[model samples]
Structures are given as structure tokens and as C-alpha cells.
Target: MRLKERTIAIVLGGGKGTRLYPLTMDRAKPAVPFAGKYRLVDIPISNCINSGIRQIYILTQFNSASLHNHISNTYIFDTFSNGFVEILAAEQTNQTDTWYQGTADAVRKNLKHFHDQNADYYIILSGDQLYRMDLKDMLDRHIACGAELTIATKPISREQATGLGIIGCDSEGIITKFYEKPANDLDISEYKVADSLLHASLGKHVDASNEYLASMGIYIFNAKTMEEVLNNDKTDFGKEIIPDVIKQRKVATYLFDGFWEDIGTIKAFYETNLDLASINPQFNFYNEMMPIYTHRRHLPATKVNFCNISSSLTSEGSIITNAYIVNSIIGVRTIIESGASLDGVYCMGASFYETEVEKTANAKKGIPNIGIGRGTIIRKAIIDQNARIGDGCRIGIDDIPRQEGDFAMYSIHDGIIVINKNAVIKNGTVM
Candidate 1:
């Protein structure tokens, strides 16, 4: 089938991110606020639209309202054309009366919808990733190679390759060995070092230059292949589906040598946002052409008071009160209280003023009713909307080394904190 004639691509947005606790408490992983103003879901959908694939169906389960609302408002399908982007929420069908079990299971449950659309191919993707790729390129490669399935692969460090579905492909790009999160071993050959401090500077201990390819959780499957697998599946694509197909030796590797960051973990999620603040961003969000689309909050220009602001993205409706903000991302309607200091923080909209002052005071005494706090300093922290911080709390914990604890925390490769929405920190507490 030609790439343009492909039926539709299914984006899996149903994962109830338990890992991103406080943030996923009220919204799905895809709906979680990211960078300064956008949600995690925007990356994939924007990629799809820009890649010339408009017929999309997002599979959703937990906290689907926010996801649904965002998709509807931001992505209005063209009325004149047959192509459309839609959301497939869980419903009680005749074949099943339960919620989706996993990634593969979710699609299997909704096979009836796909049948109605009559798509020629199925492009399956993960919603929780930060990358800019041309999907059309992958589709073209898949068709040209005449393969039943084409999986996306990217090179990663051996130490960071543990949790991924690693693969060893032959010279012709046919995958030879497949391991889902293999144990540490000297089984594979390493790459030669350039010896320069820039290339080989992870200390001499990083001797092995093994070029292991990790699955980016993106796939292009023929419709027949999808139907066959889904009809005979009880497991997910990552854990069971892909591995099972690869075992048949019919899957080909589509090597994606480009910038890709998986926001599946807390740490990765935090680091991706901070990367946007860098002087030369790894991912450029400001690209007017082929821009990453998000629901425009239509917020007025951020009001700045007597504050020291530098290298930050302060979205509309954010009020910088006599505070100092450096290398941070503040979302819509966010008010940084007087005397507060924000460094390397991603803050969303929320304030104690949303509710009765006494109600907020009961939870965290001395916290400002206006929102955020006075004399509070945040470093490498993620603050969700409407969280009230007391007068003297330090939001980010970069000063001290990273620590694992009871309060739900998400950190990326680089040590950065991910604060989810509506998360309350008790007054005087240091995270």
C-alpha cells in the first residue's frame, strides 16, 4: 500500500502514569503539562500532523476529559475533507465490557473502529516522547523495503540501554538479536574511541563503545499484519507483540539517527523541559514552520513587576512579582510571589487564591494566598498548578544531592524534579 493511502495511525495515550505520580494524579501522561506551556501529548500529535498524517485516533483511558478537551480545541479536523483526528475513549462494546488492559489490548478492543475506517496500514506510536521526526520517511522506508513491520531504532549509551527493547541488526538492517532490557554483560562488541575529551569523556571506565540500538516505541505495520497480531494477542507491543513478531524474522529496523528523548520517566520528563531553557536548545519549540502545536491558552502577555528575569519562557497571564526568575518556564496565569526566587523550575498555573484563603492555610500555614511564596527559592523543580508554597520553602533540591523518598519524585538523566498538577507541599518543607 502507498504511504498516503494508509488507513490511520493509532497513538497510545491510555497509560495511567503511576510513575509520574503527583502529576498523573489528575491527568493522563499525555495530558501532563510540559516545558513551560505545552502538554506531553502535543509532541506526538504535532509530529503526526506535520508529517502529513491527519487521520489519527488517540486511545485513551484515565482522566480522558482533559485529553479529549485539549485534542478537540487544539486539533479541529478539516470539515471539507474525509480525514479527521479523533479520540477513542473506553466504552462497553458487545465484545468486551472492561477497560483496556495494555497497549496491544487497547487497540484490539477498538478493532471495530479501525474496521469502520478501513485504513490500509497502522502506524502505532507512544504518546509520551519528546522528538521531531519525519514519520513519512519511516513510512516510505517501510513500503520500499516491502516489510510487514518496521520498527524505529535509535542509538543510546550502553548504561542507559537497560530498560529498552535492545536489538542487534545485521548489515542489511535486519534485526538479528532482540533483548528486552538485557542484564549487564560483555556479550556485544564495543565501538572504537575517538580519544578526544569531547567524544570519550565519560571517564576511562566507559571503555566499551558498543553501539546498541534501542526501540523508540514507534512502529509501522501493514494492516494485515496488525489484524493477524491483534487477533492473536494477549500482551502489549513493547513486552510481547514486537518481540513475538521479531522472533518470526519478518520485522526490519528503521534506523532513526536523530535527536530523540523519551519522556516516559520522571527524570527524562524533567530534563527535557530544562533542555528547552538552554541557550541553544536541543529541541527548538519556537520553530514557526512545523511548530509543535498546543492548545493556545490565549493568555495575555505575562505581567512583570520589579523582578530579575533571564533566560526563561514566561507564558501568558504569568505575573512576576518582585521575584527573580532565571532559566525557568512558567505557565499561564502563574504568579511568582514577591521575594521568591525561581531557577531551573517549570511552573504551571495555580494559586491559593483559587480557593478560600483559610482552606489553603490549613494545609500549609504561612504560605502565600496569592500563589507560590515569598522568600521561597526553587532550583531544578517542577511545580504543578495551584500548589501553595509557604513563605520560606525551597522548591528545588539541586543544592543537595538527589535522594529517593516517600514524596513522589520524577527525575531525568540529569537531576531535575518533575512536579505534577495540584500537588501540595506542607509549609517549611524542603523537597
Candidate 2:
């Protein structure tokens, strides 16, 4: 059988993404909007599809309604392809009734469902990451090395290795030692990649600063090996299973020097989204050969009227009128009235447009409409979906320092103001 036929992909929908806070308040991390259009889950699924792996399963637990809806509406296969993208949510069973404690536990609970496929290899992926990787290359390397388990690793600077799992490998790419998030003062030169290996993978002119090989948390394992490893009581792969398995198994490393970002924290999520609007973003969503897939809302094209938008991305079904937006992202169904100014902002637009009657009713009640009102200036902020900003509002524009914490209607995290979803700001309000 071909690689696509014998390989099954398992995407682990992350636990309550507390670091991403308000964005994950009502939805799972994978369901959170990304790049003004796609969800975080789309990146992994799209990569799998592009690599010809169609038998996929996404294990979800917390706030999965939106995720289920998106998957149902978007990834449908024909009758004869034997391709399916299914969700295996945590549930009560004869074996266990608790929620998923960690990534390994999530997969172990769903192994019965996975076994129906009778696949040869299992590729495990994370849901809340942004990257475009061809897994076929990783799988080919796994087979060529005659390895039981393979991990995808990336070369990073020593400063970046403190928070990541560092791996030690020989020149032949066989993993020898693994360290989980070593302390800053600890001496971990033993975990550093050989300079010659770096030269082979990243070219001889590679930066001398990047000597550590950090695990990318992307793994490929033989089907029986996965079953054998999960037979233990380990709850997480990185913290428990990987470190133990390296000493006993033939674990190899696949060097990946592509652009990959772990969108686990609010700051990383915000910065990564804004970077997509750059002229030459590190992660390109416009690659025609490996297109990212998402829900097709059948919305009309975005309509802009005399708006000065530069270095920004505007999604479909948006209507902008005489707004000054720069270095920002305007999401779907967004409406900006005249004289509104936005800089370094990500406005996640409304889900539905308010009709004339509804707008008039809200006006009588002294409430702002569903979109940004006139003459509002916002900078370095994130406006969540269905937010209402009244006229003459100033958000994140002043030089005043705001405390970092969750407030009634919004949050200030990492010096960036995030207006909560469905929040309403009165006219002449200043932040």
C-alpha cells in the first residue's frame, strides 16, 4: 500500500488554552480564528491533505461545538475515496469517564477508534500551531532509517531552547538524549546538534548562534509502536513518553528548517496574526500548491470605499467606508464607518450584520451597533467578533500605560488590549 493508504493522522486539539484567554473563552484553541480567515486547526489538516493523507482524526474535549461545525461543513470527501476527517471527543466509557489529562491520554482514549483503520504508521500532530510541512518527507525519512519512532526537530538559538524540548543527536540523526525545557543556568551543551549535522541540513553558512535542536512536537511512529508506548500511564508525550522512549527505541530525527510558530500564548497568537499582513510574511498563506482549507462561507467580496489600508489583510464580506487602517487585519463581515482610524490592530468582525430595524432599536437603547462607529481610533489591539465600538472612542492609542489583567469588557495582556467578544463600548469612551 502507498503511504497515504497505510498512514493515519491524529491531531490533538489542545486543552483549555488559558494562555490565549478571551479567544478561547467560548471556543477551543483550534477553533479560534486565524489570519482573518482560517482557524488554527486548518494548518495541520491542510498539510495532511496536501501530503495525501486523508484518514484523519481530531481529538477534542473542551468547547468543541464550533470545531465540529467547521469540520462538518468544510472537509467532505466523495463516496469512493475512503477519505474521512472525523472527530473523537472525550466521553464516558467503560474504561474511563474523565477528561483528557494531556496529549497522550487523549490519544490513548481514542485508540479503539483508530484501530479500525488498521494503519501501518501513525502521525501525531498538534492543533494549535501554524506551519506548512509535507509529512511525506518525514515519513520517508522514518522508513529509510528503519526507525520505530521519528521526531521532527528544528535548529534554534540557545536563548530559544530554554522553553522547548532539546534533543541530542549524532551526525547520523539518531536521537541520543532528550531534555525537557532545561533551566537557563544549566549546562546543556551535550544536547546541542553537531556543527557538521547543522551544516548538512541548514547549509554551511547557517548561523552559528543556532546550535540547539528543539523538538517540534511533530512525531511519526509505527502503529504497533504507538500502541506499545501508550500502554503505560503517561499523560503527556513531551513531558513523559518521549524522554522515556528515546533510551529504549530506535528514535530518529528529521530536521525541519521551515517557518513554524507555536500559537500557545496570547502574545504569540497576536504577533503571528499581524505578521500575516506583512509584505513578505514568514508563513505564506497564498501558496497555491499547498493551500490551507477552511469553512467556505459563500460570502461576497469585501467592499472598500475610499479606505487607506496598507500592509493589511481584509477578508471576504467586509464593508469599509473611508477608514484609515494600517498594519492590521480586518476580518469577515467587518464594517467601519467614516473617520475611523486603526493601526496595528486585528478586528475580528461580526458573525451577522445588523439590519436597519435592529440598528435603530439599539440606537434608541443608547447602545452601539455591531461594528466600529464613526471617528474611533484604535491601535495595537484586538477587537473580537461582534464587538460594538461607539462614536469617538479611543482604544490603545494613548501613551498611557494600562495594567495587564482581565477587566469587565476587555483584557490587557502583554501590553496589547483585547476587546472581548460581543462587548459594547459607549460613545466617547477612552482607553
Which ten contiguous residues of candidate 1 have the minimum total lDDT? 192-201
**TM-scores for all candidates?**
0.85, 0.98
Worst 10 residues of 2 by lDDT: 198-207
Per-residue error at 363 for model 2, in Å? 1.5
User: Over 4 Å off in model 1, which ranges?
Assistant: 190-210, 351-367, 396-420, 423-431
105 in model 1: Cα distance from truth in Å?
0.9
Give the count of colliding residue pairs in each prediction.
Answer: 8, 0
Give the candidate number with the greatest lDDT: 2
lDDT of 2 by residue, 1-431 (tens): 77789999999998998999988888988889888888889999999999999999999898999899989999999988799999888899998889999999999999999889999999999998888999998999899999999999988998999999999999989999999999999999888788888777666476788889999999999999999999988999999999888999999999888899998988998999999999999998889999999888999999999989999999999999999999999999999999999999999897888999999999999999988999999999999999999999999977887999999999999998999999999999999
Root-mean-square deviation per candidate = 5.6, 1.2
Model 1 TM-score? Answer: 0.85
